[model samples]
Target: METLITDIKIALGDNDDFFIKRDYLIEEEVVFLGLNTLLDITKTKTTLQKQTESLILKGKTTQLLFNLIGDVFENDTKRAISSILEGKLIIFIENTKQFIIYEPISKSINRSIEIPTNENVIQGPLNSFTEDIDTNIGLLRKQLISKQLIVHTTSTGMVQKTNVSLLYLNDKVDQKLVDNIKSLIEKNNDLEITDLQGLSKMLEFSSWDTISKFNTTELPFHASQFLKRGRVILFVNQLPFALILPNLIWDMFIVENDRNFPFPIMIAIRFLRIIGILVALIAPGLYVALVAVNPEVLQIELALSVAQSREGVPYPALVEVIIMLIVLELIIEASVRLPKSVGQTITMVGGIILGQAVVEAKLVSNLLIIILAATTIANSTLVGTQSTTSIRLFKYINIILSSLYGVLGLVTGIVLICSYFASLTTFGKSYLYLNIERKDNSG
Candidate 1:
């Protein structure tokens, strides 16, 4: 009991200097009360002492001679510890180990609220989840009041003690999937509790060299949608994002805005997104392969134009393409690191001025310029940064392979990438078989 008091004092320190008073109720009966705030000591005297004794004596086999303090120790260890640090006073009755927890929350609620940047909406709730897990959970719980809306939370990060919640509808969700997620989190391996990326890498079935085959989302609407579809959602405290499982390649092409738009418009946009991904992934590679080795496929006028554009350039087609690609990537990197307004300005100036200058200098062909620009624009159409990054990386592999074996190498790279995707499985479920209908013998 004294150790607990010491811990409380240490947690409070100079910020909350609660006075510890020891007094006698009757002869041989003593009480110790730790008071930081005045309101707790003033209201309800006899009940406070009774509540404290009951709490400390809870589940105890031996009779405690000391009168325990009430209000503080009623909760479990985690909640009790959390309350103490948050400015709840712990008072103990003398000759007993019972204690009471006083509620005097030091939290301030004056901050102005704003729309979340990551989870912007066209026609939904403007509010987004913040760093507070209770607030986030409250938002979700208000939306889903059913008993089926299960919120199982666990403390992660040994030192940080971060709260991680697994939310799902008990009746609608698969029990096996829930158990799998629970078990995975329970392991609490040192490697499993790092940054979000580390957690993802541990949970994801992608190989050491494989690109990310999962989708991450920040919008609660998306998460709620997935929950209704019998999917599981994993949310980490202090992280603005949540991870969805069993995501397919097509998932990346989807946007929350799709639900607001008309079905036909959404379908058209989805088709365009699919096309964008393909073009972004392979356009530059195809251009490099065709120009370097397969000129026979080009029309006479196109061939002449490319040849004219390449004239007086010292580097080979591959070297020139590689150089331009690297430069474009550097500009993109710089844009990401710069401030938002500055980044936008740099993109405009770099996209136009530098690109046009390089084309006029005969350092790169005009056709290549168009292809690269198209690829960049296509990549930008992807909703998630992960997908965009994956596209960028595959583009490199495609370029290199295309340069080596021409069109055949590009085809081979595609096959290899597809094979890798085929090999991936999350929680023992195949990642790429989302649309495949399976036979349900029992049904």
Candidate 2:
């Protein structure tokens, strides 16, 4: 016991927050080890003192004394040390050479469940996941309310040992899919995962892929929906979002809240989102192609009007599109990184100033300004930020191709994107597969 204490002290170093409280229990020297910030010192000490008094009055044996501690108590030295580090109170009985680790009485510091700010839905549960994992699990359980909703927890990360939970409907999910997810997690057990991105990469999901292989959401209702669809959900400690695995292409177009609306309305909204994606992806390219390479395709009056619009622009259509795209991207990045109030002001002011200045300087046509603005607005309609980012990035491909071969190049770029998406898979499940018809579709 003395050697274990010494090792723990050495490992923790001289941090001022680390505390050791010595006392007497059942005529044996008792010691409590924990972090001051994490443990409720007064409550722990009082509880220990009261239990010690009770044992003495009853003349209980050491075996009885051990029974009073929680089930988390262990005889293993390494595990005891780990528990102490993880904010658990470690109680050592010097004479018996025994140690019991249990939960501390720390104040609740987690934020209360609130409406999701990022993934807003018009008619669904407003509650979002919090930083506390147990709270998050409780939310999931409340929504699922089924015995088949299985949750398995394991610790990862070398030094910090962050907890990760795997959730799925046992009867609904495929056995092979569960095995595959567990296998990947076990292989990456040594990784120091600090966030969702780290875990995604550890699972061998490519970060550079244009389409995200995981659908992340903060709403427990959405997570429940994913589980019902036979998808695996991963929840990391301290992260406010859960990751839905084997992210399919259809997941990008559908929103969980859509189910609350009329069927036709839901279908119409999804169709509009798809249209938004297409316009965002191909609008700039088509504009450049028609003006620079395929002007003959337009009617005489429309072609004449386009020519008049571009009369004062000194640069080629491609250069002009690229310049505006860069500016738009810069504004977007800056707005996202800034405070919301400041971001709105900056975006509005920056767009007006840059658009006016560039047009006055005859650098880009007025018609191209409208096209880029519309394209930027359309890009915002994608389901997730990652998906929106992918769409925005792939637009450059269409822009480049159209510069080379006009409408034909734009069409080719679209086909290439579709082919790439169709060829992709996550955990052996095809990305392009649609699971709308079946409840337990594994593809």
Candidate 3:
């Protein structure tokens, strides 16, 4: 018993919350050990100790313990330590050198379900996925409500075990896709997955890849909708969002809840997202190309007006664009990281006052400010934030190319982007990927 207790202490070295309590079960000295922070020690452990004492009188120590607890790990100190950390009550019978490990009352560790702060709800379910994977799966199952919704749970991580679940509709999901995803995970079992980026690495995606291989949504409604459409949704423990794999080009322009509107309205909404993406990608580069390289393309009167707006700007068109773009990027990043109430104030001050100040000070042209504001607003229209990253980064390439070769370079950059999307693969599913119908006997 002393050896086991010392082993546990050694395993969790110097953790102040770890504790061991000595008590007697009717004159038989017993030891209870666990993390005090995680275990319910005040009332629940006391009641449990009383029950163990009563059970001991009725039968032999080992026999009664095996009967009462039904989970006894003998001499496996590693397993014992893991159990203790997981909030299980550990009782050791000192004289016999025997130990029984069973679950105790664990303090409430998970937060309640709250509305998604990331994904805005249009006309769908309000509650979103929480940090608890089981609760998230439960939320999904409540909406899916079908036996065909298969949840395959697996444990991953190198030193510690983390539970991950893959949810897909058995009747609609492709068998090949499921097998491929499962095989990729099983083959990389040794790879530690602490976050989504780690999982991306485990999947062997290039770090330099511009577009994310998956799309994320905090909304359970969107998750369920994706599952119904024959897509796999990955849920990592403690991650409060669902990752929809092989995120396609169309996902950026499409919102599942847009179906709530009439057919014409839905089409119009998707069209607007497409238009927004185009404006975001083209505006900054077009500003540079027109003013610096292709001023002759504009009408005579328009060219004169553009020249007038840029008159006081000391820097060339490219430099002026770069300066304003950097300021805009800083403002955008600050607004996201700050607290919501503070973020709004920062946005107003940085966006309105700072923008007007720069134009008046002639540090950047007024036309450049209008172009950047439009780019920032248009960037937000993309469906997923991860999807927006590609545009945000690639737009710089467009700006550089446009500044050099005018409209020709911008066209080349756009073509390269199209080719990049075309070359992406999500478990062998490319930009043109779609779900294969499940065979009737498959499920």
Candidate 4:
């Protein structure tokens, strides 16, 4: 260990300060002090004894002794020695080579808890999770006061030393789902698993391919409900949200408070969001088909009105709709990136001004303006921005296909979207369609 430490010092150079020493038994108790100027020896002893005694009691260590700032050598070496030199304390026995590293992490930076800005609900708690892992766990424990709740913590990242926890209910969760999640986590050993999104991508079986595989939410109550329904939740250190697995596509459309509402109302809201998703994705395509090639399909009065509205416009129906769609999308992107106050103002001004100006300039028909405005409003109701953006993209694809090939192309696009969605699965479970086996668990 001494030679290894010495070689490491030379290899690492002055970039890192490493001090090691040997322990000599003094007065029945052993004492060896090994620390660089980087460590505060005055408190290292206290932190060291506090960290290792439990491991020693568990029969993992035979003896412990303080090492001088330079006494450490090959006699008691471990790879964790570098961490010890960096303010962590390492305790080694005399005969064997295994050692335990303790981190008395400095509590220097303090962060105050703030209300959740993005997911604010008028009735729920204003408090939100912070960067601290323990604090986040405490928040969950408070919400789910149950003995069956199991939280398994493991160290992830060799250098990052990030703490990741797998939380689930003991009896309710399926064992196979837990095993599958563990398998994925173990396989991605060397990949950087820092953020929740990175961890999600690594755990995804089809990460390199196109697939909607997992569900993530910031609401704690939403997580608690999922735990009760036999799903696995992954909690990453410093991340405000947790990832829930084996997610059904229908699950995302259901809100956290849906179960609290009357059954009829819940069903209505869920169906409404589903309808909104359809409108957001296909409204423009429908408008293009009707106005561009099927104006006779509409009744006489409506057809005449549309014809009169577009009489002064120079562009074709498809071009006019696509142009307005692009402008609306730009406004939406800008609103999302701006501050909340500014976002509201931008949405209002952009919606009213652009809508009126386009009609006044005879750029697009009045009916198409209404269709585009409805499409934008429908897209905003989705819970997650990721899913919303995805649906928005699909909307553009639908518009392009309809513009080129008319009504039949819109039908073909629908079939293709259904086929793509149906082909996705997470760990052998269906991702898009609902399972009727558990008919009573819709809530």
Candidate 5:
């Protein structure tokens, strides 16, 4: 049974990080194996000693007993060795086929919690939340005080146990939703969950899911509001934001802070946001369709102006749109990656210089400049990064369809988008469910 362990040692070829020791865990004799380079030696041993004792006392055999970032692997020579490379400690029973992967405390990350400089909110709420789990929960605890307020903490990841805290109003929260979430967390107890996107997989959302299943925010007030409305707030260790489940379609248009404004003003703003959504989804496709495939759809003067703006451009309307879109995406990516001072200068100067240069060079039409600029601006109007990304994905579908079938393709794209949204669900609640209210219906 220790042949697997023997094989790993040979494969590693006498590395300094690879070390083993004879030990007794829970009165069971075993050998401890790990890489010293990856593990914080003192913390790793301490966590396993305490957490394993708790697991046994709680009548659990398997859990965060391996590499902190990986899962419980099969009894294979390669994977056993791979787990060691991924910063996991393996506990092999001397004569048994069983082996437990103990928690590996990773090297400390050197950084202090800072406010999010990336995202901007119109109706600003104070976000004093930080990376530390205790500090974040303490912030939320101050805002939510009730007997039913449950903050259930658990560990995930096989390599290292990352803390996950579930905050919900027990009396108000739907039991089914909580049960379902807990079950997934338990099922994947040995799997690492570092981000909400990975958590989506735990919820069984497939690759085709364009709309994010949860809403994320850094503000304690926002998380508290969602909890009161019978929604769950999931806090991942070191994640600066709290993940609010069942990200509904309305989240694109409505936010809790907006209610501070007068009702009519909120309504007007929401209406404009909806219009922006449509523009982001349809503008590029509509422009291509009208210019290339359905010129007669436009009035004579408008069509003439469009044609004149496109003069001397050497590519088809679709290619021209794609070229310009790629440039826009490059600029956006660059802006995000560069420093703030540099990013602003790059975006401002890049947009002006590039836009003018492309038009003069006839690489793209002048009319497309107006449409794609509007598209980029409208895309920014959506609430979440995930929402904007999902909507942005649909434009490619629309572009392809419209290039083939004109106005009919754009209509087809719209219908498909609607149907997709209608079928989306998060924890059994419809994605389209807007207002926060209690209901018995899970369908």
Candidate 6:
């Protein structure tokens, strides 16, 4: 027993937080090992005393003690050390190389469940996921009360061992998809995944790819909806959001709030969102293409007006577009990094001042400003922030292509983008496939 204690001390080193409490259980001496900062020492001691007293009354035997404890592990030093590090109270019985591990009352500092700040909805559940994995799973279970909803949890990260949960509907989801995901996770068990982004990078195997193959949401109801639609949801330990796999092209225009409205209204709103996405992606590029290469496509009056707007501008259309795009992007990034109230003020002030000043200074044309303003507003209608960012980035491709080949270049860029989307796959599922059909019996 003394040797075991010495080994534990050596493994933990001289860390100030490491602690050991020695107690007597009848004729045997029991030692408790844990971290002072992590364990609720008072509750742990009380429970230990009560359990030991009861075991003594029943039978003072090693087999009886093991049966009472229910978590006995035979002499494994490494496992004992790991359990202690994870805040579990490790019990060492004298003369018998056995350990019992259990969790005691400790400070669980987790954010209170509150309304989602970013993914707000008018007619759905308001509560969002908190940082606690148990709380998040409880919220999901409350919303999706079904026996088919399976949650498989495992710990990743060799050093930290962060908890990861894979949630899916057993009856609806394809078994092949589940196997693929589990295989990927098991293969990367050595990775140190601290957040959703890190886990996503590990799963996707690329950090440079701007497109997200998963739909991330903080709302449990949203996650439940996706699970019913044959999608798998992944939850990380400390992340407040859940990731839905096999992100489809249709996901870009989906708005969860639209479901609250009437059927016709929902359809119209979704159709308009699709139009908004298209306009956001191609409006600036089309404007530049028409002015630079295909002015004949415009009516005489509009063409003359556009020409008049550019009369005093010094830079060419392409350079002017690039400059305005950069300024707009900078304003956006600044607003996001600033406080909420300050961000709103800065965005409004920056947009108004910069737009007016640049046009008056002849750096850019008035028509271009209007086109860019419309484009920016339309870009916000995309479902997820990631999709919006990807669209914003891809717009530049269209702008450059239009500058090179006018309208034809814009067409080519759009075609290439569609091709890219079509070619992309997540967990062997095509990005373009919506997975609306029922799975086969084999699935």
Model 3, span 88-136: residue lDDT tens: 8787877766787867777887899999888898887799999989999
Worst 10 residues of 2 by lDDT: 434-443
Who wins the TM-score comparison?
2
Better of 2 and 4 by lDDT: 2
Q: Which residue pairs in candidate 2 collide?
A: none
User: In candidate 1, what are the lDDT values of residues 416-439, reduced to their tens digit?
Assistant: 778877877766667575642223
Local distance difference test values of all predictions, in order:
0.68, 0.85, 0.83, 0.69, 0.80, 0.85
Poorest 10 consecutive residues by lDDT, candidate 1: 61-70
What's each prediction's clash count? 16, 0, 0, 20, 9, 0
Query: For model 1, what is the alpha-carbon lDDT of residue 4?
Result: 55
Supply the TM-score for candidate 3: 0.90
Q: After the best TM-score superposition of candidate 3, give how far the Cα of residue 84 lies from its true spot, in angstroms.
A: 1.6
State how far residue 239 of model 5 sits from its true place (Å): 1.1
Give the least accurate 10-residue stretch of model 5, judged by summed lDDT: 61-70
Assess candidate 6 and give its TM-score to the true structure: 0.92
* Candidate 6, 49-168: lDDT as tens digits: 787788878766856775576478876888888888878888788778877777776655568999997786889889999888889999999999999999999888888888889999
Q: What pairs collide in candidate 5? A: 65-101, 65-102, 66-101, 67-88, 67-158, 67-159, 68-159, 68-160, 69-159
Candidate 6: segments with Cα more than 4 A from true spot: 24-28, 47-70, 436-443
